[model samples]
Every structure is written in C-alpha cells, then in structure tokens.
Target chain A: MTGSEGPGHQVQAIGNDEDVVRVRQLVRTAAVAAKLSLVDQTKVVTAASELARNTLVYGGGGEAAVSTVDNGVRRGVRVVFSDSGPGIADIDLALTDGYTSGGGLGLGLSGARRLVDEFELDTVVGAGTTVAVVKWAR
Target chain B: MERVPILKIGSVLLVSIQVDMQDQMALQLQEDLGQRIVDTGCRGVIIDITGLDIVDSFVGRTLSTIASISRVLDAETIVVGMRPAVAITLVELGLSLDGIRTALNVERGLELLARNAEPDTFDDLDLLGDPETTSP
Candidate 1:
C-alpha cells in the first residue's frame, strides 16, 4: 500500500466499524507523509473518522481516499470520501450544527469542517455525496 | 470482535483502551461493559486512555456514551489519560464530551470514582486485600 503512485496514497472501505479504524489509520499515514505536526495529524484523523462514519451510516457505504498534497515547499494531506446512496436533500441544512438526519451529535459535518484547513462538499439528490477535506502542515 | 479485557477489582470495573479499535470493537466493549457492570455489581468504572495518543469525535463520543449509559445503570465513570492534543482537537471539533468526568491517570481516576461513589471502599481496603503486604 505504501508503494503506490504519486497522488494515490491509501484507500480503504467505509462500510463498517472496522473500516472506520482503517480510515483513521490511513489518514494518519497520509498526514505523516505530509509532514503535518502531531496536532494537525490528530485533527485530520478525527475529521476523517467523522466523515467516514457519515459515509457509512448516512451514505450507506463509501470509500475514503487519502493522498499527499505538495505545493512546492508546503505539503498537505487531503482526504476524499465518496458514497453512492440516498443523497442529502438540503446541503445548507446538513452543514448546520444540531441538524441530524440520523442518531448523532449532528457534528459530523460542521465539526469535521472546523477540524480541517479546507472542506468541500457536493451532493445530488438522486446521485450521491462527495466530501473532500485537506489539512496542511504547520 | 476484539475484546478489551474488563477487570473487576473489588467493586470497580477497570478497562484501559490500548488497542486500535474498529467501530464494531468499540460497540462490543460498550455492551460488555454494561453487562459486566450488572454482573459484578460494580459501583464505579474507570477507563484509562493513556495509550491512545489520538482521539477523534467518534472515540470521544464512545467514551462519553459509555459513561452516560453506565450512569443509568448506577455506575460512575471516570475517563483518564487523554492526551493534551486530543483534548484540544476535541474542543476544536466541537465535542465537549459533556456529562463525562475525566482524570489525569488511572490511579487518580480510581481515586475520584472511589471518593465519590464509595468512600467507604477506600477506608475498608482490608476487605479486598491486606494492601500493606500484597500490592505495592
């Protein structure tokens, strides 16, 4: 898994509890590769956990893909969670805190957004949801 | 499927989550803990997370969930050994871990639980063991 292409770091399944752990581990590895500090690594990993769980529980299953980002001198890690399921109806409401369609603290979206340096989300009602987050080394 | 051993010391249940747990494993631990609390009649629960250098909202909520559920079953929970980085991340991530008590280490967590849940248990250490001779 370590010997891969430049942008391809690690990809893991996000269908169950075990998969969530794998996602966290893979994100940590990517964070390390990006030379992120300990705090940054933890924040990215935590955000990854929330997003992965959201993929599994809400999206019915997805794949978490983490890769390294290098902009000349600075390096970063980006994680993308893509799922094909019943897509969200309202993007604005979904990103709002205390708005949960399922049983959770409703922090999956907003809380995860706060942990990363960059966050992007796309959802089509009949298609699916794709959330991408990036944490740069500091 | 992986089990974090639950040890019953006197009337307290102690578990240190030192493994990289999957989602299923965490849920199993929760169930096992609830059952152990009922079976042992333990008055207190102390979980040590000194081994976990990183904790996300999922893990944080798991700890808080266990604590909250244990309260319903008449058991007090004290989570100890959270790394400073994890705490800061948790705060930034918006997980306050509300309604859960925390401590610095296992010894302190145990003391906190005992002091609040069963003050007499510490006073009557002789009942569990001759502490002067056995445990150092």
Candidate 2:
C-alpha cells in the first residue's frame, strides 16, 4: 500500500479493528512529524480513530492515507479515509449527533469535524464516500 | 484477541488496560467484566486507562455499557486515570460518557467504591437511636 503512494503519503488498509489501530498510529506519527502540540496530536489521533472505524464499519472497509502538509508558514497533518461501500444518502443526517444507521453513538463524522482544523466530505449515493481532515500545528 | 485481565481486590474487581484495544477487544472486556462481577459478587469495578493514549466513541460506549451492566448486577464501575487531553477531546466529541463514574487514579477510585461498599442498613439506623426514644 505504501509503494503506490507518493513519497510522503502513507496509505493503510482499514479492513478490521487492527487496521483502525494502525491508522491511528500512522496519523499520530504524521501529526508528530508536522510538529503538532500534545493536545493537538491527541485531538487529531482521536479524530483519526473515529474516521478509520467509520470507514471499516459504515463504509464496509476501505483505506486511509496520512500525509504531512505545509502551508508556507505552518505545517499540518491530513488524513483521508476513502471507502467503496454503500455511500451515504443523507450527509446531513449522518452528521447529526444522535443519528446512526449502525447502532453507534453517531458522533464519528460530526465529532471528527470538531477535532480537526479542516474537514471535507465527498460522497455519492451509490459510489462511495471520502472524508478528509487536517489539523495544523499550533 | 488479547483479553484485559481482571484482578480481584477485596470486594472490588480491578482491570488495568495496558493495551491499545481494538473494538472487538473492548467488547470482550465488557463481557468478561460482567461475568466476573457475577462470579465474584464484587460490589465495585475499577478500570484503569492510564496506558491508553486515546479513548474514542467505540471504547467510550463500551465503558458506558459495562457500567450499566455492572449496575444491573449491583456493582459500581469507576473508570480511572484518563489523560487530560483525552478528556478534553471526549467532551468536544459530544460524548459526555453519561452513567459512567471516573476518578483521578486507582487509589481515588477505590475510595469512591469503598464509600458505597456498605449501605445504611437497619442496624445502622437503630444505632442512631430509636425514633420513639429520641422524640423531640
């Protein structure tokens, strides 16, 4: 998975629980590499865990890419979780705090958004879903 | 499939999770705790998470469920040793972790449980002087 990715990007498969843990570890490494503070690292890592699990449970398994980015003055870590499963029909509903299709707390998407500096969601009804989030060093 | 070991301490059961638990492992801990609570008739359960770096919604929900299950079995559950950062992130994540008790560390958690170990029974009420004899 790492071979096909760019030089700085680390891609990991999210097929099960272990993959989710690996995703979190990879994000943490990238976050540290980008010089994120301890609190920021914690926040981003927690967000990564949520998104990775969503990719596995809701998205029926997928992959995550962790990359460090630089925006001139500041550096940051960005993680993208992509899944080729049943795409979300109601993005807003899925972002609701208490709304869940899989008996979870339903806080994965919304909570993840709050944890990072930038949050983006791209999805299609039948194709799949991709969630990207970035947390910059402070 | 690594299991979280549950240790017996007097009337309380202690589980110190020193692993980066997966979702399935967390669920297994919940089940194991419930069984231990019944088998030992423990009145309190303390889970130490000082070793964990993060506690996401899945693990948080499992803790809540375990607390509820322990309550149903007449046992109190206290989660101790959460890092400051983890707590802040959890609140921001909109997970209040309702119905779950927490303490600063294992020692404090034990104190909280000991306070609830003994209820105010009829004997204790009698010790406070009979109502008829102590009438104003």
Highest DockQ: give the candidate number.
2
Kindly provide the TM-score of model 2 when superposed on the true structure, using C-alpha atoms: 0.92
**Which candidate number would show the highest TM-score if scored against the true structure?**
2
Model 2 pairs whose backbones collide: none
Candidate 2: regions farther than 4 A off: A1-7, B121-136
Strongest candidate by lDDT: 2
Deviating ranges (above 4 Å) for candidate 1: A1-8, B118-136
Per-residue accuracy of model 2 over B60-103 as CA lDDT, tens digit each: 99999999999999899999999999999999999999999999
For all predicted structures, in order, the TM-scores are: 0.88, 0.92
What is the C-alpha lDDT profile of model 2 across A1-138, one tens digit per residue? 111222378899999899999999999898888889988999999999999999999899999989988776788888999999899999999998888999899999999999999899999988899998989888
Number of clashes in every candidate structure? 1, 0
What global local distance difference test value does model 1 have?
0.86
